[model samples]
Target: MKLLTLNFLTCAIKACKSSPASFPLHPRDVELEIVESDINLPFLKNILPRLMWAELRTIAAELGLPELPETAPTRDHLVEGKEEAKEGEEVDEVPSQTARDLHRVLLETTVKEGKLVCGNCAHEYKVMEGVPNFLLPGHLV
Candidate 1:
């Protein structure tokens, strides 16, 4: 699963819904892979508001990736040189270093194999072949 997708996932157990800990399910014994693709700056800008920055930082730290900034970056920080645009002529917006780093972490990083453990329930959700199995057994459901 892409780290981007993991940002939106929560614990599958119905009982864990009310817990703050359920979101940002922690990775354990992970086998990570980098699946590179073209970065979409617009998509990054659009999704900035929805990211759980602290949780993402924690996940990155857990996976032994580089540390994130103390605060979440604003959408404006994702692109460079808006001021350079002329009155009528459109200027190309270049992705900033911040944007590139964000793209690397969120889009390129993949969990090839791992267990996502819920902080609330301590339930382990297996991830295999870059796909997370979120389905719960009948009792968990």
Candidate 2:
């Protein structure tokens, strides 16, 4: 699954819902892959506010990826500048380096195989073939 997906995922156990530690499930023995795609600048801008920056940084560090910035980048930072457009014409915005880096980390990076462990419950969620299995047994449910 894409790192972008992990940003919204938390521990599946119902009991762990109230715990802050349940978020940003820790990756273990991960096999990572990079699947390149065109960056949607608008999507990145829209998702910026929803990201748990600190948790994302922790996940990246745990996965041995490069350290993220101390603070999250603002939507304005994602664009370099707008191209001059004629009257009544649409202007194009150029994506900045910050946008590119964000795209690389959130969209390109994938977890091919791994275990996402909950910090609160210590439950392990299996990820196989780039798909995460979050279904819990009756006890966990």
Candidate 3:
């Protein structure tokens, strides 16, 4: 999973600076898109070297989601990082993952108000007061 960081205060400041109606739960300054895929080792191999796990974990925890596992998941494998368990508590590999799984996790699990993260670029979109801040100001890391 591409780790992204959205500084709540920075996001809020940017949002409010652009518009007075911006708020934490109703953010109106960002937009996000989650990409689902089937690529395994190759995909992760390509991006893993570019991310900062610390940044990624911060985003996940802020959203009240479980953290990814400590050991790196082997390619083509789905290790339920951390989320609500189903009746079976098990699902297909392709359907459950971070780096190789789809990015719709956030969109599908909640209302249209919260933080959004890109699974590829690791970009973080802050959604407050029903708005998402997709703006990247400097140092496109």
- Best-matching candidate per TM-score: 1
Report the lDDT tens digits of candidate 3 across residue range 1-141: 122223233332343445422322222223333444444534454544444445544445555456655544443343343245456665444434464332333223333454654433334566665445666766355
State the C-alpha lDDT per candidate. 0.89, 0.90, 0.42
**Relative to the unseen true structure, what is the Cα RMSD of model 2?**
3.6
Task: Itemize residue pairs with steric clashes in candidate 1.
Answer: none
The TM-scores of all predictions, comma-separated, are: 0.88, 0.87, 0.35
- 102: Cα error in model 2, Å: 0.4
Candidate 1 displacement at residue 73 in angstroms: 0.9
How well is each residue in 1-141 modelled by candidate 2, as lDDT tens digits?
A: 999888889998888989999998999999999999998999999999899999999999999998889999987678775333356665567898889989999999999998999999999999999999998887565
Q: Sort the predicted structures by TM-score, highest score first.
A: 1, 2, 3
**Which segments of model 1 are wrong by more than 4 Å?**
81-91, 139-141
Tell me the lDDT of model 3 at 30: 32
Superposed by TM-score, candidate 1 places the C-alpha of residue 52 at a distance from the truth, in angstroms, of 1.2
- Where does the lowest 10-residue lDDT sum fall in candidate 1? 82-91
Which TM-score value belongs to model 3?
0.35
